[model samples]
Target: MYFFLSHLSVCDILISTNVTPKTLQVLLTGRHLLSFSSCHTQLYFFGAFTGTECCLLSVMSYDRYLAICDPLHYSFIMKRHLPQFLATLCWLVGFFVSMIIESFVVALDYCGPNVIDHFFCDLTRLLELSCSDTKMTDICVTIIVSIIGIFQVVFVIVTYICIFTSILQISSITGRQKIFSTCSSHLAVVSTYYGTLIALYVAPSSGHFQTLNKVLSLLNTIITPLLNPIIYSLRNKEIRSAFSKNVLRRLKR
Candidate 1:
């Protein structure tokens, strides 16, 4: 689990690095000027990372389900090489999807009004910028989200249901509580991350809900990524202990 989590931390940091600084700059400087290439570049990386994190979170949920529900076979099932394979799969899935979609996205020209309402170059916002009809690109993204994104979310839900059932089977209240505590933080994080994403993609986007879309995008792009590391590490005793040993010690000096 920690193996998957460390990768998630790295993913979170990468996404945040890609979006946060530029987003803050735009927000603070009140300068929304961004070249077409630069905008799509950010959009690609952001899309890739978002997809990667979706897969990673589902992978994490699988890890937790195995850890809690099948403790006896956990080590055998989640072998050493398995984590590496899963993490790589997550990255590959995300990047490949984005590369395909963004190639199409960039092909479409932006010859008109470029004032993006959202903070960053989001996929949906980018679709709005195209001078030509974006029906194909929009269909592609909607299909990807409907299939891949929804599948990940559903997988997480199924895993947690199994995990919860297993926890309920535990005779000791303390054991059940301990197991619940271990997963509850992750569950909360997953809920927030996936919930916002579902709302963004599943709902029909229009001028009427433009403000709502921006707010949800803000949560997904900036706030959620920032919250992830803090949520996981702060709630985790091992991580907190290590932080105290290394970072806190350095700061104290």
Candidate 2:
């Protein structure tokens, strides 16, 4: 669990760091200025991290599944090397998917009016600036999101369903409560992260809430990262204890 949490924490931090500074620059200056190369670069890393988090969240749910549902076999099933392999795979798959989407974005030529309505460079927002046909780009993104995003969300829901079933079987209330608390933090993050994404991407677009969408996008990219460490630490006793020992103790000393 710590292994997954540590990797996730780093990922959220890196994702926010990649996008937020530039976004703040735009917001503060009221300038939508970004170079062609800068736009593509930001678009690449943003998609990469978003895709990575989707996969990582699913993997974390699977880990929780093993720990909760198959406690007797958790140690054997979730071996020392397994977490590393899964985390590495998430990173690879995430970046690879983003590369494909960014490649499509790069191939397009921006004729003029390069001002993006979005604060940060996004593939969808960048598509608006393209002079060429966007049919292919739209198709590619739809495929990637359907495969990586929606599939992962369903996988996590199924894993948690199974986990809940197993939890119900535990005879002790303490046992049930312990397992619930352990998974609740992850569930909270998953709900907030995926909920905003679905609102942004999967929801119907007949009525476009441009300003609201952008605000939600900022939450997904910025506020979520800032909150994750707090969320995990507060819910996780071991992480809280370790933090107090390492951080608070040093301050006092």
Candidate 3:
């Protein structure tokens, strides 16, 4: 789990690093600029990391399901090489899909209307600004995002249902609570991340919802990454204990 978590941390860092600095610059200086290549580069990495994280979260849910649902076989199933393979698969799929989508975006001709409404070079905004016909590109992106998002969400939901069934089988209330606690943080992160993601990408975009889209994008790009570590750490007893000790020491000073 920690191994998967470390990779999650890397994804969060890459995502925030991809989007935040330029956003901060825009906020601080009231201006932002990017060359043609730079913007597309950011867009590619953003899509890659986000896609990877979606796969990772689904993977993690499967991990928890095994741990909770089948303890005896858990170690055997999640062998040393298995986690690595899964992580690698996530990374590869993410990059490959992003490459395909980015190709679609790049193929479009952006003749004018250079200003993007939102903070960064988002896929939808790029499509909106293109002078070329974007119907096909839009349809392709929509299909890709729908498959990725819906599949992951459904997989997580199914795994958790099984996990919950296993937990309920435990006669003790304490056992049930303890088991649920182990995954509640993951559930929280998944809900927040996917809720905003689907809302932003899968839902139909419009002038009426441009501002809402930006807000949702902010949550997905910035806030969710910031929250992942905090959410996980808060679930750790040792971390919480040390945090309390540090707060007390600082208070004494």
Instruction: Give each model a TM-score.
Output: 0.89, 0.90, 0.94
Q: What residue runs in model 3 are displaced by over 4 Å at the alpha carbon?
A: 202-204, 244-253
- lDDT by residue (62-87, candidate 2, tens digit) is 99998888889999988989889999
lDDT of 1 at 205: 66
For model 1, what is the error of residue 251's alpha carbon versus the real structure, in angstroms, after optimal superposition?
A: 24
Q: What is the C-alpha local distance difference test score of each model?
A: 0.86, 0.86, 0.92
Question: Candidate 3 — worst ten consecutive residues by lDDT sum?
Answer: 198-207
lDDT score, residue 26, model 3?
87
State the weakest 10-residue window (summed lDDT) of model 1: 198-207
- Candidate no. 1 TM-score: 0.89
Candidate 1 error regions (>4 Å): 202-204, 237-253
Per-residue accuracy of model 3 over 1-253 as CA lDDT, tens digit each:
8999999999999999999999999889787888889999999999999999999999999999999998899999999999999999999999999999999999999888888777889887888789999999889997998888889999999999999889878999998899899999999999999888878765656768888888899999999999999999999899999999999999999
Q: How many clashing residue pairs appear in each of the predictions shown?
A: 0, 0, 0
Candidate 2, residue 45: lDDT: 88
lDDT of 1 at 122: 76
